[model samples]
Target: MTSTKIIHEKKNSDMKKLLGILLSISLLLAGCSISDKNKDLSQEHLVLSTIWFQKSPEAKALFYQAFNIAKERVVEFNKEEGEKPKAVVVDLDETMIDNSPFQGKMVEEGKPYNPEFWAEWTKLSQAKATPGAKDFTLFCDSIGVEVIYLSNRLTTELEWTMRNLDSLGFAFVTPNNFLLVDETSAKEPRREKVAEQYDIILLLGDNLNDFAEVFQHRGDDWGVSVVEKYKNEFGRRFIIFPNPMYGDWEKSIYNNERGLNENEKFKLRRKAVTAF
Candidate 1:
């Protein structure tokens, strides 16, 4: 080969080697970054989701906004001519009452939900009312509209749940008005029972499942399509509060599977997110 051609070939070979080294270094750096991120995912820290729920002014505003719109809708619904009595069905936790304290406790302990801990929390009867919730319910009461508290809290927790609501000065805490989960978490039957007696003008809750059974246990989309399907009903007949701590929406991330360990859930949560 000519001397010039030999030198040119050597230069091309050197360039290829340099490029390969740079690419390998880049991959190593990316791997380190990912490892660092996962290492810091310790549950000891307060979850950002719970932090947003507990501290954000916007979160408080959403509750107020929901109830304010609900009050207006109540007035409008009452004016309409209907044979059945007007009623509003409200979920307890994170909807009519603030349960972020309980969620915060769990977050502090680096633990997930346990029925035993939940029952103990309920027995305390210390949860306060959500923003504008008490006032809106009182407004409904003044207008002669029945306010029914429909919650998924187990029947065993009924006494403490009632005590907590009563402590918060909520209206209609009686046995007839407060309905707890008896057999299943599906609230459709309880809703149907309420429908038999009242018009059910508005349903207020923090979770979509609180509105309808259709929103529960859907695929990985987490019922986003269902929410879009019922888009118009929001702020009209169904009011939703902000709750980032926990909900049935999380079930979709796990494919509705139970008994997943912390690491499995952590992996699933990371995988469920979209990344550029």
Candidate 2:
């Protein structure tokens, strides 16, 4: 080969090597991102999914602040010009109780949530209280505001839930107060029942459905329309707990169909994102 041709070939070879290294680094970083996402979004790595709960000091502070604010609202509402039976409705999971440990155990055991899986976890009845949850309930009880647990947890888990709540120092917990899932997960009927007796001054929940049934089976807007409709109620009468770990919001992008396989969900979620 000519000397010039030889140098040109060597330069090309060097450039190719550099490009290969850059491509490798890109793939490596992409792989790391995928791994972290799997840990966060997949059932197999459910414990790692809740890293936000364990790692984020802001989340802990938010819980404390949310409950404190709820207490303040309760006090204010009690002093309002209403003589009806006053009550504060609350969701159990991820709101009053921190079930991150249960999620961790399920992940560790390579188990996904099923009827049996949930029954076993609730039967253990050892979920810790969310930050300030106990105090918030206590404050409500002290002020004579009946604390009602309006959970989506099935009726079968009622006993376990009661035991768990009592163990966690939650006050005003009883069969009458803990309204479990009946014919529907909408919770509107149960909430209406509670309303029949007590004026629901506040509804505390992690998911939007806990507040109203309109959020159920919502579209890509993710109940944004309904929220806008009742925009004033939020942070006033509807105190929400942060629960990005899992909720209907994630399902909203994928049409809220739970039957979609993991890969299908992934595709839908990716498509739902906004990028420049």
Using TM-score, give the best candidate's number: 1
Misplaced by over 4 Å in model 2 are 1-49
lDDT of 2: 0.84
Model 1 residue pairs with clashes:
none
Top-scoring candidate (lDDT): 1
Candidate 1, residues 134-207: lDDT per residue as tens digits?
Answer: 89878999999999999999888888888888888888878888889988888999999999999999999989
TM-scores, one per candidate: 0.82, 0.80
**Cα deviation of 29, candidate 1, in Å:** 32
TM-score of 1: 0.82
Model 2 pairs in collision = none
Regions of candidate 1 where Cα sits further than 4 Å from its true position: 1-46
lDDT to native, each model: 0.86, 0.84
**lDDT tens readout by residue for model 2, 75-117:** 8888887768799999999999988876776666544567787
